[model samples]
Target: MTRLWNDPADFADEMIDGFVAANTRSVQRVPGGVIRRDAVPEGQVAVVIGGGSGHYPAFGGLVGPGLAHGAAMGNLFASPSAQQIHAVAAAAHAGGGVFFSYGNYAGDVLNFDAAQDRLRREGIDCATVVVTDDVASAPADQASLRRGIAGDLIVFRIAAAAAEAGAPLAEVARVAARANARTRSLGVAFTGCTLPGAAAPLFTVPERRMAVGLGIHGEPGIDETDIPSADALAEQLVARLLAEIPDGASAAGGRVVPVLNGLGSLKYEEMFVVYRRIARALEEAGIDIVDPHVGEYCTSFDMAGVSLTLFWLDDELAALWDTPVDTPAYRRGAITRLTDAARNASGDGRATASAASVDSTPDADDASRRVARTVLRAVQEMSRTIDTHVDELGRMDAVAGDGDHGIGMQRGAHAALRAAAEAVDAGAGAATTLAQAADAWSDRAGGTSGALWGVILAAIAAELGDTGTPDAAAVARGVHGAAEGVVAYGKAEIGDKTMVDALVPFAYALTEGTATRPLADAWIAAAATAGAAASATADLLPRRGRARTHGAHSLGTPDPGAHSLALIVTAVGSVLAAPEEES
Candidate 1:
């Protein structure tokens, strides 16, 4: 088990601070993440890459010359908020446009798309290429649904090389996408990883057994089998990758880069031994190996796992692969180091936007302020509810998905509670208070559920205007709007075994109940409906998010997202039933 941490919630920020301090010559600290300390030429396209923070060298260590220009680091196993991504992109931007790339996870997609749209609205050109290289995650016919793993290094290197060579934004994006399409990776683990302050590992495997197709986020593996010998494991990895060669690429006589990556706890000596057999296997198949890599490139926090990636190279890609790189973790060829004076001349290059303070409260009357107080109390109740059931939620999610849903919801709820209190203290109206709380929840949590909750709360806040008292019908309309917003934003249906399964039912029941019942009574009935719907999700297979790949494993477990939402709504009903004077 992992040890060492003060306040697990603050671990990511503290780690980033120490990293920037140690790598001052290579990178400088920004609000959201790190950027290269060296100066770049005018009109050079900035290559920004990132994901969750647990994958160390993957994100921050790659921020330097000939690699990512900047990296937007998020919390442990979580995607960064849209505001954080935008900040990193803006700081990394020169006169040229920004190019974004990362693993194709749900949270990363939602936040990156939002930041890309925001940048476009501000007149800054942007393009994206999401890496989908893990062949084990999806079938070849549905390759677009796969997630990225160790192959991130190959794609990031090629794209950053193109950008460094002064290629336009479109060309850089094209090369990155091409590189991703040609790369394939598969991973297996002997044991699961433990998050900081956690009582146990995310999931466990029987002794002498290995889990196959495990994700980097502590997600449970899709299948398991008895352990194999080093040579046999290497052959298995090579055969699986060779089975899914990209179209027009021949395994025989093809040029490929084989990367034997150790997840985290695996020793370099073990990986080298495995790579020896991998090299022999490829050579025996008449394939030529180029720039073979054996070491840690991307990793889980402490997983004893290894993944092998094969990058099929065309002529252009082969040429680009020879580019010199100088980063904190990975380096190639000889390159001149930047002088102290030159590095000193260049500051952080951050271009930050000014934010409004809590003291500047929106205009409101007595009735709206009263409702805002109730909103604050409701948030407090939700936080307490999450704290009480956090462990249970984590256990449920660990059945198939990454076991961080409980911690994520706890982070979001606490952040929202604090923001609501601040807004209430500033004499804000219900709309402003709830809106601020929504932004806080999304910003701090930084996951799929976080983004969805932000959408839901923001829609309701819009319906509950600041000026007058919102009636029962207006409240029902707000709930309906929230349901619509979640559907449009998350793209999940009721039977997808996600939060939508419960949220949609609750919204509909509440709308019908409010026609003849009081607001509090209607909410109580809707909360019961949500609870039943959440329970029913156990019979459905997940069609979205990280759980989709491990569908069979989640057959008897309810989705943690849906269950958490049900819990929150039920808790809020009690707050709404409080005395009128207290509200």
Candidate 2:
């Protein structure tokens, strides 16, 4: 039972503010996150690390000399928006390039990739290395699918060290990938973590039992068993990590760096007790131990858990690991601190983009503007529907995926509704109105669903031109276009137990129904098909994304993305069904 927080929604922001204030000598607050107080070299490749806010010391604390140049802080347990990522990357960029690194969660992947794309378009070089070092998330053969955990420290350290040593962007990225490949981590949780202001834990372990392979964001473990003694727990952790040695790491002479990490509430003495056995286990196996770490490096709010990470080292990596580092949390070999005059000479290297904001009001015809108002109403109705069902959606996701879908949908829908009303005020047509809404939703949501929704709206808006009032056929074409675009972009088939399952049927139903029925009637009929398809997903197992590894656990629950889509589409259909005179 964790306590002490202001408004739950504002927790991440408040935490970041205080973090920067306390570490003013190490970091300065940038627009999206914190950056090193002193600027980087003219040609130094900037390494930017990021993740959700709860994992302190991991993201923000590591931003200083010999580590990350900046950290993109997102909402608690949520990935940063693409806009936020881009802003930080731009601010941290030096003459060489910018390198992005983070855990390989679905939301982080989507948003980071999008930001990388955006950066490239603006002529700033950017590359990404996703850390997938959690042994519990996937089988050894499928290591790419594993989620990153406490092992992020290894990857981020190596990457930043590579950059600090005058390595180019490619070298920095390569070293990061190598570190990720050689790293492996497994964790056990005595209890699940409750999000701020949430009534209950995201997932729970039974009394006298422990959950193995739990995620940082309170995602339930893949396996559960009776709790073990500290010695037995160390054995379990060591054996699991050693079982899957990376290529060329099986030799007795290979060096290894062991990190015993405590999630929020665990005591330091408890960690030392566990590390005692861990050290013996490694020594018995003839693996040379490097700078062994035992403390909280990454945390999951208030969860009582710990993870063991082993980073198999090569000569180059071994040398790099010993480099001096001075930061808010961790420190290594003594390094000369910048003089006050020198530090004051270098200011925060921030880059701002000037956005064009012009009133396009009066350009849209009266009829189109009226329809925009109707779309705004529909957006509001969809938001209300999502607000009513947030808890249910979250429950569906906690079964397998990180349990943040409900909160994510609520954020996206609210942002979209606000953007839609503003677009209406700007005298935007159906196309421009929806385009603005989609951008806002994706920007605020910052997840797989948000990414998908953004693409869907972009495709739909392309079909509905601003010049003409979009008729039933035009809207139907947009619907089908959206379906094709989503499938093409997300690469999920109908049977994959994603939102595609509902979307494909709804797309077909809308096209067929609109051929003869009124627009509102067709929308209602299509929404019904989506709703039924969403319900039917309870019988199907997830075959994509994070839930794929925990399929059995999620078997009885419908895909939350699909279910939320059904609810929103149905709600929006009702708004469309009302008499035109109502608008």
Candidate 3:
């Protein structure tokens, strides 16, 4: 699709115009597209940084009260020219002098060094610090040649705080250099992103694969492999960074601050999943994390990936890193309640529980149950039919997802059936049997869909228990409850093109059809609606879920989960519609 930019040549100028226009009170464009604001107190030393655009909040977004004084912006993924860098330095320099900071990219080095030379010749004291933190960018012996990633934020904050405290220009540079020494980062990408107005991605990873160590600007990665689970990815990243740190010393003394940054297009939820794993890994390694930040601090437009940054801290730099700083992109030192000891203890315990809780009894009914049961049965039947071809349903999931779906579902279903049969053998009603089934399903299937499905079945059983009898209206209520459960658990809605796309419509159809027809008739109509809804998903671009990484490739492929839901509904209808003697 075409972008709002008039052309590639005008893209940078247009972007800067919009940036300054929107941030008039906070920033202004100096000559050469450098963005600056008058330093907060006006007399403190000034920090200036310059780099290519795209890595927002780095060179430009960091310019503020406790960060940078000026930022020179360049064309997308291209370093700002030497002239531009010089202009930003001159604008930010106070009588105390200017401290220039930038990532270690060849273009940035050549240009910023030239600007530094020019500034010194003109009698303006200028100092420069290059960030080299990306472990995957170079071997240990060639650490100085590594590319910078999110650690730039930590280094910039330290330098800016020194400048804000009215430190000498040389001192500010020293603090920045020290911060850079303690920081390390690594990144992985599932897919590349497009430039504005571009027809195709700047780079590409193979379908259903991930490229690790990818540069933000679309540089080739270390290697491409089948997409790993969040836990696996986090383990890999944290291990590499930990190895980069000196033995027996925290990069931040005994404390560490982590930044889990999304490259772009990765959802906040997915990032948190990665964070959970990283936190566990760090804790295992005896690293104390004083604070953690996770978000899209840097981006390649719409790329589906993320990076991890770790900052080791000394008392002085840590104090500066914690200093009150506010900018459009970031905020620190906001007075949140001091974490209570009990609460902190509980919080740590909760992570363990979350990991262990997968085997617990399913919660009350929600939309997910109704939808999950329908999808589960359908997937089970599909597996039966495809069983001769392959041994497991996970293989089917592997066709489109992480390949755990088949094993997870089979295990959950087997658990559910066993639980149900035991309950039934104990003279329990269908409701009790179903509830037991739900608990078993949840306990066996531990990932996202597993918990969701478990909640759904248990909820349906609970609703049935409350009513004491099963009929058309009761079935309708059960379906409604199932839909609610899924929504509550997954938090996905219709157009996100998740299972909700089919479930929501099917639930509505069940309620309407049951009100006007027999139970079997209602189920048939609901199944038809569900099938249509599942088919309709083919036209939608997935806004969430693993499918999002595939972008346009995801379009025209019925969401497997949704399709499975339709199949389950159809199967249940057949069972309910059977002859009385046969039933």
Candidate 4:
């Protein structure tokens, strides 16, 4: 039931047939099952890449003007036969000779080596490069034994560029080998993927858990753990990659390019969230990120996971990366540098802290301090509530989720409030206090909501720190900061039925002259809108987040997490707007 295939025995042949049919203009199927295509400047050096059928666009699909000149496509999760590889080598050779490249799988090695020997016997000059980039697959002493993941793209591209530039077969192979040596990859999978026509998945994963370092063919992962938030997940992946890269590997004189890739079926929003974290993590680690690529460069048949690839560049490989290459699936030389421009345009070429800008002038009513106190009190109260309802929340989540919401929220809120109180008592400035509080909450809570809430509090405090007031303009700016923080951290948009549903409208409302209106009025409007948006989620299938797995069952139940956020925001507004006498 998991895989749909009419004839299991002929699935491999049928898949190849379809591939050739679709790519007829670009690729030709030769005898022995090798697919050959034309690269730029034919008769120059030849770049060949090959792998199993399951990883489409990898070996075969990459054969084009800017990619591989030929590919020996194999069966699903199986290596191509030696004869198939030899046939492709013969068909692709254009006098300059051929450079063979593929992943470092056992079968691939056996077959490619045999094919290389046969080619040499025929008086053809040939070389080989095996890609082994998965750091989790093996230790540094045995990096060659690790499996290749998304990082294969970097290797393939480097080889193709070198070959297209008329490098000899030996030099082309050297470039690819160098890239493979510098490259490293790691991945985490939340679910297993089923091969076509198979009734069961290739592997198994526990409900609500994830497997780190899962192979493309559903191979066993290196480690298993609870599913983490996108930020945590990205951090874990990037940290592992950083540790693997040699010291000074990403320095100014060094070459480092980052690639954020999805396993399969991961939404673009989620991918973007992962990229945001990876970028931040790399920057913090003093790794200069260059030539970043983000997308589904590699896949595992709808597996819900992501991988990170780091290519430590040298001068030669960097030149190849900068080379122009265009293909149906991959493109280089046209990527815009908008991120750098946007960053520089924002004043100091650095991300502005929302609180730092607002801390200059205190509000006439001292509303900033009062609101901070109120927020702390609310978090404290919510912590107690969460402790009381932990069992109930766990039971509710258990019906369809991981059952950690209650505990996560309680821990996160408690940490935030405790940190805030301590900062205040220690005479820490508002912005510093909020940042500390946010960090504490995020460290303790450890979930999606924890990160989001931490970002929100930090942004609010940063904005207040800049102006030290609660004027109309300041409130608007604070709302903007909060919204941006939520988006930056959560990557949820206006209609994803996330906390954004409430927070966005509230922020927009403040932008309209309604900022001077009582905080309760604005909060009520925002909460009501959010509640409506949350209710609307009943009609939409969950697209992102923990609720995605339930499918239709997720419909008709207001997202509990979003509902909780609405309640908290409304409570804060009410407290802030209340008259002194009422308090």
Candidate 5:
């Protein structure tokens, strides 16, 4: 359980601030996250790694001399936004290029790929090596679909070591890919973790039971069983990993880096005891153990669990693994230090400022100003509505997925409202206001829902434009565009039991109703239809994303994403109707 937090919404921000302050000798504050204040060798590839914030010593704590050059930290259990990743990569890039690494998750893949594309467009050489090492998440044939857990350390170290040795970007990325391919991990949880301000854990294992194959982001496990002793757990983990040796590798007589990792709140003694038995078992099986790590490399907030990662070592990988590392958490042998004094003297640690652009507010037409006001009103209503339903939404999401949907929506909606208000105050038009809000929502929330909503808002904003008030037909087109954008971006169909389920029907109803009816009346009707569609998800088996792992356990519960979208659209409909009644 999280005991100390000023405001749940501000936890990530505050945590970063304190982390930077304490580890100033190792890392410096940057726009997206922390970058090593220490200078990199000239023309060396910058190893920029990150994901969600909860996994300490992974995304951020690894940023130092021989690990990650920079980390783009996101909100708890959420992937960093594309803009955030871009900011960190741009700040961290040396003369050579930028190499990106992170866990294999949908949000991380989507956001990191976007950042990589953007960097390439700007003529910055950026390469990505996604870590997929949790064997329990997928079978050997579907190994690419696994999630990276504690095994992230193995892949990250290989890339950073290659970079430190002055390898080119391509070679460094190749080294990382090799490590990711060879690594395998399996995790089990004795208890679920509670997020700050939450009433309960994301999911729970019954008394004397354990959840096996759980994810690092509070995602419930794929299976459950009665809790076992330390030696028994270690044997099970070792057996599971040994069964699937990397392609062209033999489990027996293999040189391996076995990392026994504690998922937060698990003690060092527990990990040590477990690792002892694990090491003895490996030796008996004729496998030679290389450098073994036993501690927290990755964490899931305060989840009471542990994971074992086996990184099968080749000659090249063994050399990379022996390289020195110095970070906020992990440290190794001596390396050249780039003191902060020298960094400050050279002005290398400060964020480079960009030239200001010309203001676009003056281009807004008078009619568009009125429409922008309405958009602001609806945004305010959405903020209020999300606040009211945050707890309920979390409860619904806890039925299968990680139970942060409500809190995520609250953060996004509030941030969106603030951004929209600022745009409106600046005399911006409808498109600009909505676009600004969209960016804020995605950045502040930092999850799959946040990214999808950002796409949906941006699609609508494109049709809103700046010159004049958009008509019913134009607005309907925007709604339809939002539906299309969400489906395309999230890759979730209507029957997949996601927000797209409600969005498609709402857009169709709005377009059909607007053929003759007023915008307000049509919106209200469409919103009602969306609400019903959201409720109907209770009967559909989830076929996409995280909920799919939980399967039948998610049945009888409305999809949280669809429910939240329905709530927001319904609130906005009322806001739209208010203006009509006043007129």
Candidate 6:
């Protein structure tokens, strides 16, 4: 369990600060994350890698000489926002290009892709290689759908090695892709991890039982069985991975890099014992083990579990794998010391300041300002509602997914509320206020819910311009737009057991009701519809997100996303029904 923290919300940022302070010789703090302290050669592709925080020696700790040039560390168990990713990439860019790589989680993919697009638009050539190597998450035929776990270390290393060798961004990306394709991982858990400030573990295995095929985000495993001895466990993992060797890779005579990764709390001695059996098992299968790693590469905070990753190495990959690495946490081979003069050649490793823009907001009309105040009130109510139901929501999510949904929603709502209040105090219009709130929510929360809420609010803000008070029809259009925008951005359908199940029906009902009823009445009806739809999601299986990995474990539970959406919309409806105060 997580025992130390000033505040749960500030944990990630505070941890990064301490990490950079301790490793000042190797890394320097940037706005979004950390970058190398030393200089880079001109026209060398910068290899930037990252994901949610809490995974030590990965993401941030890997930022140094032969590893990642920079890491865009996000909130614990949440992907970095597009803005955060872009900032790290921009700071890391050394005139050649930027190569990005990370675990293939949904939020990570969305945010990283957005950052890649933005960098390209700014004429900074960028490429990405998403690591999808957890064979337990998906079948062989659907390997692309697998979540990246410990296998991502192999991809990050190969990509960074190619970059250090002065390969172009395209070449770096190609090698990273090849590495990901050849990597296979399977994880099991003896227990679960607790997030900072959480009262208990996210999920737990019964006494004497072991969870197989668990994710790194504190998600419960897909299957459970009686705990086995070290040798038996090693055999099970080796056999599973050996059975699903990547296409074109033969087990016999295959040169593989076997990484025995401890999730978090597992002791080094325990992992070494497990790896001993793993090594014997691989040798018996006629495989040549090269640089076998036995330690924590990626981890779920304090999870008493381990994962095995086999990176089938071709000639090119084998050579790349042999490259020297000297990160804060991971070091390999001998590295020549860089002189202080050479290390400071890049001049503090900070990105150049861009031209400043005007920071003033245009004063809104009387009607729009009044509407903005009402928007602030609605956001306030939503925040309060989330705070009230946060624990319940976390419990629902813990049934099949990582139990951070409640806290994530709470962070986003409170962040949005703060932004909305600030905008209202500045006499901003409804559109500008809501837009600012959306950005804050997304940036602060840094998760799937955060991104979707940003999309939803921004879409509505677009319909509610700064000029006048929006009528019922206009509000309905805004709600409809938000629904469509969420669908497009999240790529979740009505029956996917996500928030879409509630959002779509609510949008439709609001659109229909507003045609004949007042805005408050229409919203009330829509909120009720959303509540029912959210409840009905219990009957559906999750077809998307991390919960899908657990399958039947979530059968009787309502999706936390769906339930939170319903709660917020219902709270907003009550605000709409309240009597208007004087402007």
Model 2 agreement with the true structure over 1-583: per-residue lDDT tens digits: 6577998767788899999889888887776687887767888998998988788888999988888988988887888878778877877888789999999887788778888998899988887889998988888888888899999999989998999899999999999999999999999999988888888888888999999998898888889999999999999999988888999887387799999999998999999999999999999999888899999999998899999999999988898898788899888888677776876576533523322344454356777777777778888898899899999898888888878889888888899998999888778887778888888888777777888888877777777666657888888888898889878767789888999999989999999998999999999999999999998888888878778778788787889989998998899898988865774
Q: Per-residue lDDT tens digits of candidate 1, residues 194-273? A: 88989999998899999999999988777899999999999999999998889768988899999998889999999988
State model 5's lDDT: 0.88
Give the better candidate number (1 or 4) by TM-score: 1
User: By summed lDDT, which 10 consecutive residues of candidate 1 come out lowest?
Assistant: 348-357
Which model is ahead, 4 or 6, in terms of lDDT? 6
Query: Model 6, residue 317: displacement in angstroms?
Result: 0.5
- Superior by TM-score: candidate 1 or candidate 2: 1
List model 6 lDDT by residue over 208-239, tens digit each.
Answer: 99999999998888789999999999999999
Residue-level lDDT of model 5, residues 1-583, one tens digit each, is 8899998888888999999899988887787788887877679999999888878877889998889999999888888888788888888888789999999887788788888988999999989998999887777888777788998889999999999999999999999999999999999999999888777889888989999999998888999999989899989999998888898688678999999999999999999999999999889888999988899999988899999999999999999988999898998787878665777676564454231243566469878888999899989999999999999999998888888889888888999999999999998999999998998898788778888889888889889988788888888998999999888877789899899989999999999999999999999999999999999999999877777767887899999999999999999998988864463
Q: What is the C-alpha lDDT of each candidate?
A: 0.90, 0.86, 0.69, 0.67, 0.88, 0.90
Q: List candidate 3 segments past 4 Å from native.
A: 1-3, 34-36, 39-43, 251-253, 334-583
Q: Please state the error at residue 169 of candidate 5 in Å.
A: 2.0
Please, what are the lDDT tens digits per residue for candidate 4 over residues 252-342? 3445798888877678899898899888888877777788888877776767778888899777778888877655466676522224444
- Model with the higher TM-score, candidate 4 or 6: 6
Tell me the TM-score of each prediction against the true structure.
Answer: 0.97, 0.95, 0.56, 0.56, 0.96, 0.97
Candidate 1 pairs with clashing backbones: none
Residue 523 accuracy (lDDT) in model 1: 97
- Report the alpha-carbon TM-score of model 2 versus the true structure: 0.95
lDDT of 3 by residue, 427-474 (tens): 455565677677666544434445566666766666565223466787
